[model samples]
Target: MFKKVLVANRGEIACRIMKSCQQLNVRTVAVYSTADKDAKFVKMADEAYCVGPAKAQESYLNREGILMAAVISHADAVHPGYGFLAEDALFARMCSQCGLTWLGPQADLISLMGDKAAARKFAASRGIAIIPGTFVLNDPDATERAALKIGFPLLIKASQGGGGKGIRIVTSPDDLNSQLKIAKQETSSAFGSTSIYLERVLKHARHIEVQIIGDQNGRILVLGDRDCTMQVRRQKIIEESPATFITDAQRRELIVTVHRLLDGVNYQGLGTVEFLFSDDRFYFLEMNTRLQVEHGVTETTTGLDIVMLQLQLASNESRLSRQIPSCDGVAIECRINLTAPTNNNQLSTFSFPEGIRVDTGYQSGDNVPSYYDALLVKVIVNGKNRLEAVTLMQKALANIKIDGVSTNLHDLQKILASSWYKKGVFAVETLDMRLEKHESFTG
Candidate 1:
């Protein structure tokens, strides 16, 4: 096992990863930016290093600085807790070349799956159905031709990036060229790659994702699926395990299909197979080659520590049991962000009710930095059933208090009380509909 692991990220994920490391009796090294010098994660680490300035390019995303920190800290492995360079194939290669165990998938697999266009082809080749889409297009003529074939109401997405960046929705052909231009520019800026692909957008699609972990020996473990349909601007805000509406047969098929696809690629470590579900059909979106933001809920449902499994797999020291464990209960998670209500820099009081896991990187009196992601904490609850989980979440959210900083607590409370949300029939557009109608449910 790795004696020390360097977490090459920040915020809630960084802290979450460190906790797993602690459970495994592994020391943790944290890398921070100038803006996070006094962050809670830094203080929690056995060793902490300031990589660079507040800007992500100079700090959290600074590959060289992170590498140097690992070297200085003598960490045997590096766990990139999603985002930043977690899915960057080159960085994974660099870590392996430096004799450090690279958590998550290998470099080649990361490269193959990171390209949204190529991943679609790969998925289709493995018998996983993909959405009606076109491969990476370079020029306006090619894009126009593809758009004509795909019809209006299509999404132009960046081939090399995720996290809802570098994507544009064009409702009609008259807006195609302009939207394509903007997507390319944003893609270039965000991922440093201008590759873009187009996919037919389904109205009222629910974002469903399957959590998968594999080993170097080709063993794949399906940790179950999550319904991340609740979103604002394509960013998931609420997620739950064992997707609510899908039938048992459909759930089994989804898991089996994803397992086959991952095995075909000889994928290693943690990954997520994301899909858009509508009309009782699953359309492959893309695979994320690292720990997901909502992994906490899955962990709660499965009773597994994903970060620990990543370490063991990367070390090639342990193999997962062949028997798949049954999911015990329903789990729900809400992302508490610094945005939405307000951005008060200071966090006066931060507390949550019992029977919930609060994964956070902030503490009372800590100044929330605008230089990074707005995520303040992930509130996770587990229960005997969906309704039970939802009820527990309500109690947790209602009693929780985080003053001095603006958070999405109120919005989340409204969502929990919404009628559509309670029925388990809500789609991605449900929240938008509530907002448009200015409806708020107190129940």
Candidate 2:
């Protein structure tokens, strides 16, 4: 096991990773920016280093600054919880070159799968079913030809994008050029790439994902399947284990498909294979090469500490079999976030209810910064079944309270009690998709 680990990110995930390290008796090194010098996660670390100033480019995302901190701290390994440089293959290589263990898959896999276009091609080459999409195109003639082939009602997505950025939905050729121009600008500014790809968009698709890992034993571990259909602006806000609407056969197939896709890769960390399920078929999206923000839902349902498992697997400490742990119950997680920039960012009345696990980085009297992700906490609950879990989630949301900042409390409640939610038939667009207009998904 690693003696010391340096967390390369900040906010709630930093706290989440540090807590897990402490549980393993591994010392933690926290690298913080000037803006987060006094954050809750900073105080939780055994040693803290100020990387740079407030801006992310100068601090959190500064590759050189983070590497320097790890070397100076004499840490054996670097754990990028999520976001920021978590999936950057170059940064992972830098850690290895510096003689620091990177708690993730090898850099080659990250580089190959990080590019959406390359991932699609790789999946197709492996005999996996991928969504009908074209390669990254920047030429005018090639772009027009690909659009005609893929047909209308498609999405123009960034080749190197995640977290729902640099995407444009188009339904007609007339709107293609306009949306394409917009997507390129966004992608260039956000990802330093001007390339974009087109793929067919399934309407009212359920966002189902399988947690998988290519263990050190050259075997695959399928943790479970999760439904992240409840989302806004392509960002998932609610996730649940044992997807409510899929059949038993479909679930089994999903697990097998991902396992087969990852088999013989010699990978040694956690990853998620995402799919858009509709029309009784699954369309591959992209693979996430790092820990997901919603990993808590699977942890609560499966009785496994994923972070611990990640550490163990990375350090060759856990030699596992192919069997997955049976689900303890139905688990649900709701992400609580600051709805918008509040007049007063300082938290005043911060409190959560009992009977649920709340993972957070803030306590009462903490200042909520607008520079980073707005996520405040992840409220997770598990019950004997789906009905019980839903009831518990509703109660937990109602009992929670906060002040001096606005949150999506009302929005979460509205979605939780909607008729679509009770029926377990909600889709990725159900939150914003007007039920009265979309007769197919209406109560």
Candidate 3:
């Protein structure tokens, strides 16, 4: 166990990580910006430091400042709670060189799997099914020829972009060139990379991901599978465990396939291998090499402490005999975020329902800084089965009360009540296509 750990993030995830560390008696250090000087996570930390100003590039994403905070606080390890340098290979390597443990997989693995282009090619070479896609586009004529073969209604994607930034859905050949340019610009501005690729859209695909963890002692655990089909613009809005959409045999096949996929990579720590499932088959998507926002859903279903697992693995604890805890029930998570700007950014009266798990970064009277993500709350519910979970979620959602900001609560309730969502008939594009008419989505 680590004596002290520095959390390299802010808000809900930062708070969440600290809680787990405290449970293990590990002292936690929080690094914040001036904007978050009075934030909840900062107050909860045993020690806190201000990294920089409110801007993420200067604050949360400041690798040097965060490292300095860890050194000054005498933290034995650093935990990057999901975003903001969590997957940055250079940052992870730097931590190791400084003799501080990095609570993640090896930096080389992160680099190899983080790039979408290289990951896709790697999956294909492993005999894993991949969506029809091209490598990094170069010469214009060759790129056009490749696009024509893959057909229109394809996606122009930034090879290094995530969180739905550098992506364009080209519906026809005429729009391909313009969409490509836009995607390139977005990716370059966001990721410092203009490298892009193309993939044919599988019309009615579902977003499915498998959670895996490996230990230093050559042990592995397949937590379970999750269905993230309910998404708005490629960002997952709802996530549930034990993906009910797939049949029993298909579920077994999925587990076996993913297990084999990570068989000999000498992987350690947590990871998620995503895929696009359609027409009784699945194609490999990208892998998230860090803890995800929706990880609690899987945790609830399996009754396992994923964060604690990460800590134990990082310390090379060989006695961890846990192996794939049986999935006990169906669990669903609704991420409530602000859809539009509001008058007062501070929470006037933020409250959540009882008898359910509500993980949040803000309490009543906490001011939400405008600099970071607008995700205010994560409502997670677990029940004996999917229907029971859905029923419990609806009631829990109804009990939530937020008086300050404009959020997606109404939309989330509508989604839970929708017949398509209830019946698990909704595909990846189903929510986006439905909301395209009425709701304006923000990235």
Candidate 4:
């Protein structure tokens, strides 16, 4: 076990990692930017270091600064909580060279899975079912040809980075070029990698992902599945575990597929294999090489501390191989944003409601800046079943309050109370329709 671990990120995830470190008796070192000088994670850690200015390029994303902090703090391992340098293969390699454990996958695994184009080829080679798509194109003519081959209503996605930042859906041929340009620009700006690929977009598909944890000894455990179908503009708003959409048979098949893929690649540490389920069939999407933002839902349902698992796995320990964690109950998570309802302006003051698992890294006096993600907190609830879990989450969201920021509280309340969502007959466009109806009614 590592004596000290350095968390190379900020906000809620950093705080989340710190909690696990505390329980494991591992000292934590938090690296923060000047903007986060008084952040909650910094206060919670045994020691803190200022990395750089508020801009992510000079701060949270600065590899040298973070490595220096880890060295100065004498941390034996670095746990990149998600986003930022979490999926950066170069950072993982640097940690290897520095003799510090990267509390995630090996650098080669990161490099292979991080690239959407490469991942598609790899999955296909291993006989994993993947959505029909084209290779990465740099020329405009080639891109148009590829788009036509994939047919209409396809998606253009970035080869690097997730979180739905650089994805565009084209309904027809006329819209392909414009969407491609926008996707490329966004991908380059967000991930510094403009490499893009195409995929056949399935209408009315449920976004299902299987969580897996592996150790150095090549033992892998599939925790369970999550249904992240409730999304707004490609961003997940609500996530639930043991995906209500899949049956026992389908769940078993999906788990087998995931296990085969992980075993084929000899994948290590914690990762997620995402799939788009339509017509009762699962099509492989890209894999996330690090912990997901919505991982709380799975943890609540499975009663597992994923952070500790990552730490143990990184240290080449395989204690969890003897028994797999079972799903005890249903769990749901609602991501509370820091934007206002009117202008979607960022908030400065914040407060959370009681009677729920409120995992947040921001305090009342902290400023919800536009420089980072808008997520303020993740509200998670566990129940004996799906309906009870939904009910508990509804009440939790209603009781929650945040001052000085506009959130989707009302929107979330409406979603939870809607007939479509209640009956689990919702698609990706469900939230769009709800928001449109709300706007029309308000107008």
Best by TM-score: 3
Off by over 4 Å in 4: 138-142, 185-194, 340-350, 436-443
Error of 2 at 436 (Å): 12
Task: Give the clashing pairs for model 1.
Answer: 342-406
After the best TM-score superposition of candidate 4, give how far the Cα of residue 146 lies from its true spot, in angstroms: 3.6
Q: What's the TM for model 3?
A: 0.96
Poorly placed runs, candidate 2 (over 4 Å): 435-443
Q: What are the runs in model 3 whose C-alpha is more than 4 Å off?
A: 217-219, 318-322, 439-443
Per-model TM against the reference: 0.95, 0.96, 0.96, 0.93
Candidate-wise lDDT, in order: 0.87, 0.87, 0.87, 0.84
Better of 3 and 4 by TM-score: 3
**Minimal lDDT window, size 10, model 4:** 340-349
Which lDDT tens digits does candidate 2 get at residues 1-443? 99999999998899999988999999999999988888989999999999999888899999999999999999999998888899999999999999998888899999888898888888888888888888788798898889888899999989898556678899999998888888888999988999889998887789999987666665779998899988877899999997877888998888778966788887778888999998888888889998999998999988888888888887888876568878888999999999887645888888999879999989999888788888998999998898889889999999998888999887788778867687787778776665445533224
User: What is candidate 2's local distance difference test score?
Assistant: 0.87
Location of the lowest summed lDDT over 10 successive residues in candidate 2: 434-443
Backbone clashes counted, model 2:
0
Clashing pairs in 4: 339-406, 340-406
